[model samples]
Target: MAAAATSTSTTQLSAPYRRSSTLQNSNYNKNNNSNKVPSNGVNGDRQVMVSKRGCNGVDNGGGFCWKASFMYWTLEDVAHVARHHWILCLFAVGLLFFMAVEYTLRMVPASSPPFDLGFVATRCLHRLLESWPELNTLLAALNTVFVGMQTTYIVWAWLIEGRPRATISALFMFTCRGILGYSTQLPLPQGFLGSGADFPVGNVSFFLFFSGHVAGSVIASLDMRRMQRWEMAWLFDVLNVFQAIRLLGTRGHYTIDLAVGFGAGYLFDSLAGKYEESKRRTSLLLHKEASLT
Candidate 1:
């Protein structure tokens, strides 16, 4: 009887230890379950990350891409979408109409120059306001900043297999046009387009120089859209500031053209964004926003 009682006491002592071990194992299994869940499972976090990263993939319905195996956009996609780029098309159409109207109102006498009342007024504004040393210095500094940033982007593109040829082309032509327009001043020529000192930023008439810049800038921006987010973010802001100043300040261009061109050039950049939908992004996308503000 004493031996039986001893056996019962031993059993009671071991039972609590067995329960404790089972509880410990259950807690371990709960902790492990979260880590081991499949990404496709209902409550997993990895699936969300994958979906977010999948933006702009080809065959993702409306999404875009630029590669074959990697889901990059085809040339056709860029062409079609770019053709209908809503904002650019709208802005271009508006500028075309405005230029056409300006053309009708302008007076190009054969004996003298081709400038009209509009050119006269714009020129007067530049002479009166932009001739100041301080304003000139500020604008010149701004122009240099724009030019330098553009160069940096192009160099980066050359080294990194990025799309910036058009942007660089735009910058080159922009610089060239500036020089040519400035040199042709003083005894401005007869053709409405070829000669004029009145245009503040460029003396080479309003329609041609402004139109070319707007057009070239658009093309470059279109090409740049193919770059990764970080690439675009790096340079867009610096470019925008110069562009705005060119449009708004009272030198070189018609205020109208400058205003219109800003939208057009900006539209070019926007088109690139749509075209390169499949490129990888970085946190630097915020630069697009920050630059404008």
Candidate 2:
């Protein structure tokens, strides 16, 4: 009986010690977990991404990054850009000068290269006219197409006069101008297309009209009427640049052709606006001069 009681006591004592060991294990686990928690809270995400997502620079440079915002430019490039468009306006002035001096240089025969696309086209057109039996009808048709005032009227009435007139006008005007621009050819020397006709009324020159559209579009973008006077001067230079870009394309026109085309467009546009003002000024000046005399 005594041995049985002793055994019971031993079992009770061992149960308490086992419980104490379990409690110590739990405390150890909690303490370890608390130590594992990062104070910064960013280590996990930083280790995975921060190293890879480095800013574009050497480590020593403190991530000083820059991008190329400026396009390439040079003095030669600037000069070329300037010259590229200036040729067009200058060409127009030169043409006018040449025309004015025609009487003085009447005796001197104008010379040009024998073969060119302009001449080729002119010759083809000439042959087609001379051989074709029903040529008069074609001539009349061509004339109607070439006539600027008639086209402008049609454009105004059918294209411009209706709903949202600005939209239609802008579209139709550009198209008409571009199309008519390639049709016209200069009346120069002989080779393929000999001197049968010079600036023939029946033939159309489209190059000129194209300038009108190009220059007109540019003018629309730079509506200087509301802007300052100095800003208005830039409009001319801007239009000239557009002309140069057109010429650089090089598929449609020769140097001279581009020059002339741009000049014509610019001049036509300028005159469209300033002609009345110019006349008024001229009249005023004439009256003032007369009074002074």
Candidate 3:
């Protein structure tokens, strides 16, 4: 009975110590859990925070941190876009302004004098030419000489230099020009200065939709550039500009015609290049097949 009592007392005394240890262990586990960052919660939500030094030495979380406020994020994105595409932004503003201008623009009356900015700018020159028919003829003669030069360069590139690209481009451009020109024949402009020495001499009928003169010059200039003849190319470009101005002053071609001529020259050159490349690829394929056989 004494031993049984002693054992019972020992059990009662150890029970409080065990309970205190259990409580301490539970508190420690709770503290550890509270200190730990949650990778995932019961609802599968994950939250993370990382500190990193920013450009200004302040903690910015990280380089691509998403913890920033909405307004700040939006402003950062806007600044990034603006820095890279400022020109695009400028054009966008221009687009809006032009839209407003177009909306407010008045329609021109049919009876109103044909208003052309180029014509107005060259009014004095035009008057001088009108007064001196001989001077106009002389200018036409000089322009013809320039045309001859362009023709010589193009032909020489094909026949002498063994480069057919310019020739092919010229042929393609002229053929397309002929088709387009005949399809819609614009009436001759008023106050046109005719010259006996001009191409299609004696005021013969010609297409007015696009200027072949400008197109031909562009073709020659492009070929010169390809040949690395910088001096010749520059000369062609300057003469081409003068030719365009003279054409405009003489009422030889409309503004749209000259612009389209420039485009056509570039377009035809590209097409010709593509054609040559295709031909070369075909030849290579045929040779390879023959060798394999």
Point out where model 2 deviates above 4 Å: 1-100, 103-169, 182-209, 221-224, 227-236, 242-293
Clashes of each: 12, 10, 0
Better of 1 and 3 by lDDT: 3
Whole-model lDDT, model 3: 0.78
Q: Tens digits of per-residue lDDT for model 2 on 1-293?
A: 99998655443312223333445447745764665635354554433232253322212333232322123334543454445457665888899999888867635345634334443434555456446635534433432343332235334534554322223334544565556644654443332221112122333443433444334434333333324434544654564453334223322234454454445444544544465467779999999999999
Question: Per-residue lDDT of 237-286 in model 1, one digit per residue for the tens?
Answer: 44654554443344344444444555655554554444455343543566
Best by TM-score: 3
> In model 2, how large is the Cα lDDT of residue 72?
37
**Which is the better candidate, 1 or 2, if ranked by lDDT?**
1
Ranking by lDDT: 3, 1, 2
Which ten residues in a row are the worst by lDDT in model 2? 191-200
Worst 10 residues of 3 by lDDT: 49-58
TM-score per candidate, in order?
A: 0.34, 0.24, 0.70
